[model samples]
Target: MKTIEIQIEDYITNDKDLISVIKRVIKDKKKILLQAPMGTGKSSLILDYLSKEFNILMAIPNTAQIETIEKRNGIFCLYGDKQQKGYRSETTVVSTPDRLLQATECFKTKNIDCLIVDESHELYTTANYRPKFKNIMTLQSTLKNTSILHMSATPQANLTCLKGFYDIFIKIDSKKKLKTSIDIYDMELNPSNIKNIINKYKTNNNNTFIYFDDKSMNEELAEELNLINVNADNKKNNEILSEIKAKNKINENIIFTSVIRAGIDILNEKNAVLIICAKSNLTTDDTIQLIGRFRNNLSKTVIIKNFKNEDTEKNNQSYEQILNQKKKYLKSINDDIKRWEENKIKYTKEDCTEIKKKLTELIEIFIELNEKGEKIEENHRYKINTHRVEISAYSQLQKNKTKNIDNMIKLLEKTEAIKIENIEKKDLNKKANKSFNKKIQEKSTEKRELKNKELKQRIEYLSNNLSTLQLELFMEGSTLKTLEMTLEKGQREDRELRDALRKTLSVVEPKSKYYKTIQQIKKYITNDIRDAFKYITQRELSTCKKDIIQEQIIRNNISWIKDKNVEIATDIIKNKIIFIRHFKILQILDNYGLIKNSSRISKKILKKIEDILIKEKYFDGIKKKNYQKIIMQDLELIFNLSRNNKEIRISSIKTKNMNIENKKQTA
Candidate 1:
């Protein structure tokens, strides 16, 4: 293989030399593999420069990339059920590998000068996990006559398969210095560590992006931090991206999984990247790809968790051994076919024909396996050749463990590309504790403010409803005296006013009408005074009880108790047997057959059973009689045990009776 290395700066400034190299390779009808660092303008070179001279058909790893390319370059991109007829009229057409493979018949008739495979590493890395890789294999063979250019930031595919296909390998190195600083933590990736990192970065008003492989963890951490999460399971990914791009990016932090690891650019500056690496999920290549998502050349910080790799040596098999295993499997399938043919009475002719057809396909695959060293395995009744690719890729990922990451960091440090920091376990814990304490203090302040607001509203209500005299007496802190004085004053005033009115109106209208009006006024005054006194007293009492409860909650360190209703709390505290801790005691009684039926067992026998359970540590502090009563009651409730005159007996009916009663009530 002919290898060439080019500086990215030179390629950007004067790309004539590299273009000449590619042109020569194309003239010779050879395949080329282009390796370059991400964010170094690999796509720009192809779409802007190469498309002008050559008819390019770019095969991306996914449809999302096609959309991104089309939006950026204003080129025609095809995927899904879109027609390929327009592909022939465009200078540069972008489509996914699967779609490209399906349109191979169309491509064979068109004048495609160069076929570019973007993110080509996925061809092997994700071959086993994704079904599209099968189509990729067919596309590779179908376009054997066309000039192919494979491009990736991390080309981790097995080169043995591409040895005969690709003749030239070009690696482009960036001349611009990396301004990102990476902090490596020698700890497990957990909620505590994630919280600590987010807080540290957010304190400086910097945006942060967290890359974790687990979808559930991504959603959980995003929710816990009150940030946006992007993953395959998220339905509003496009909307989330739009939100990130919109003005006022208040919640700037984001948590994403592997779905958008590549073929996406977050054009934000001063962003902090956090990669959560586990033994089973992320590898060195994945870490590199994650860091490449940030395009701006501003100073950034990256935090990663460093952990050891698991031993996968047992899974590694030699090529010859794999072939031998396949041979044995083939022999077994043949033997089954032979037996079916001999027993035609039991097996139909159609079954025999299907088996023979499958056998022929397996034999053809077996020959290809031997020729190209492709791995094969049976899925249901069909055989697939994608297994070896998965094994090879996994082994490569596993082999590059903690040491590989350390080496990559050391290389950057040696080149003066980044500043490296090691965060110790103690420091992480200290930060986590500080964050936890801050949250608690904030919650306490919030609750105090709510209580103060409630008290102010109550005071406003009282001031609005209370009379001048009553409010004055209440403010003087004399509750009983205020009620009494207000009542006496109302009675005295009422008597005087009624006397004056009667004397003034003595000669007017019927006296009975005036008497009814006077009685009504007296009754209204008396009732108003009484109701105000009652409202004031109850409000004061309720406020006092709330204060007492809040104080008790703080003193006992059971603040959660304040949220529960009084009735519910009382019920829970009074029911000693309904606790989950007593479940084991019930099981023990059941095991001893003592929970079934008992003629009120002698007090002595009950005590003996209690002693045995207590000795076995089942009953912590329960007494004998209480324990016996609890057991009997539970047995009756759950198993429908019957009690007749102080004698308990197991009823034939069980949980079915309770279920029937529940159904009847629901009906």
Candidate 2:
């Protein structure tokens, strides 16, 4: 065992808030979520707080963060020989998520007392839970005493979406003074733009960080700069520090890095210029994190988007990928639900009701959290080391239907199409309905008006909650969602069958053989499905035709893209049934233009995409919902369905083959 030591200064000793919170969490042994602003010395504070007792395992995103941590700790603790890897007692072991997951393959339990996940927001933002998430979850379950801490620079930037699952929360307040005015410019990122930025900002004494999501883009841009380019891989700690600290440089030195905000932070006060290229497949949070690196500096941030001409940008454009995936997700669950039902997989109404209740409760908590923001600290019981502490944060946004009253009110007011009020309103002077009549019903002017207002608000709340419930019904990524999808798929498929039968009947006479088959199929549908499709082929003939066309579009649209020229297929899509197929976004633009020419996509396009995927007329995003609110639900639903579908298919296929072999042997 060796002693763990770190450099402590007067500023660190004086700052009681950071040290107190860390000590309190450590003492209580509760899982904490540490959130501090940029350039606040979070790593330094953490190092200062821990002594010889706590064995720490820190999972980070980039190796640059590892370098930074090593420099602060004055030693590295990688997963190899402890002595050889420069590991001492209470040394913080750091590695990227993928690497840590790989190294801990034979792990039954974690010996480390605390596990801290840096950039914790990535877990929620990703499409599904990666191997690292699974490993951590297992670690949580296996190591009963392991204190799992999820830390992020959430407040003033974004909320940690995964906060609901944890037991503790801590938000640190650090003030950053603007010594130099930050000038921000938004445009496309390209070679010409890069050259212009370099020519303009590359002064002799200035230090610049050109951030990129893509490694190739970072390398290419660095090459384009034609300067002394250095990154995390090509430098020593002292050398890099000296290079950065060199105040009298004749020419500007640059370090173009992909690892800007994902743990690699430099505590430097040189004239800093940030060229943040927000022009990549990276999410909005990622872009914000990158740009936030220069938040503490007298820095100028140039946000050059990854823009291209209309033709070139069309291929890699980010649109409604989730909504399209949601439909596929639903269809995938259909077979599994069917198989589960056959296999007698027990599910009860009571179970569903209980789950729904819990989900609703979580959602409401989140809604209140997002609305309340920092204000709700007084309302809720939060203990952070004897201080009334609150960080820039969002509420516990659980992946369920949470009610936001203001947002709900805005929605109800905007849409006259669907009145949210459930009450049957009579005239102010007229007799009240017996349903609304009370035992001692006496209506005064003020009382009546107040009652009416209360009723309206109640109705709006009901409407909002109902919409959330319905949308979230199939969106939560669990067996519950799969079951919901399976239950709804019957109706969805029935509608299609009805439309198919109707279309066939309309085109064919009573004497036609195909008409009889269609009639028979209708009978089968009626007998098999719950009387939902009894009169399907008769009234919904046009709807059936539209469904037929939509299904065809979904099926053939892919082959058309692969084999045929897209422009020539105008005749195939002449009926304007592109939006009908929720799975595919047709190039056929309306007044809003379904696809925008601008680098940053318009909100209208997003709405169109939502409507095409989820019901636009529905609560999913009709009232201007954020992506996290909508997409998390969709992701959860899709993940469960996709996972269950694969399992069921594999199981059924294996069983069928075994039965076939048995029958062949007997024969």
Residue 221 local lDDT, model 2? 47
What candidate 2 gets wrong by more than 4 Å, as runs, is: 1-13, 53-55, 71-76, 79-112, 125-130, 155-160, 177-182, 203-207, 212-225, 229-262, 267-269, 291-296, 306-667
Residue-level lDDT tens digits of model 2 in 46-86: 56565345666667665555665666566443432223342
Q: Clashes in model 1: which pairs?
A: none
The prediction achieving the highest lDDT against the true structure is: 1
Tens-digit lDDT track of model 1 for 263-289: 666666554455444434454555555
For residue 597, model 1's alpha carbon misses the true position, in angstroms, by 23
- Off-target runs (Cα >4 Å) in candidate 1 are 10-14, 81-88, 102-109, 158-164, 177-179, 235-238, 243-251, 275-279, 298-306, 309-382, 386-667
User: How much is the lDDT of residue 131 in candidate 1?
Assistant: 50
State which candidate has the highest TM-score: 1
Cα lDDT of model 1 overall? Answer: 0.52
Model 2, position 495, has a per-residue lDDT of 46
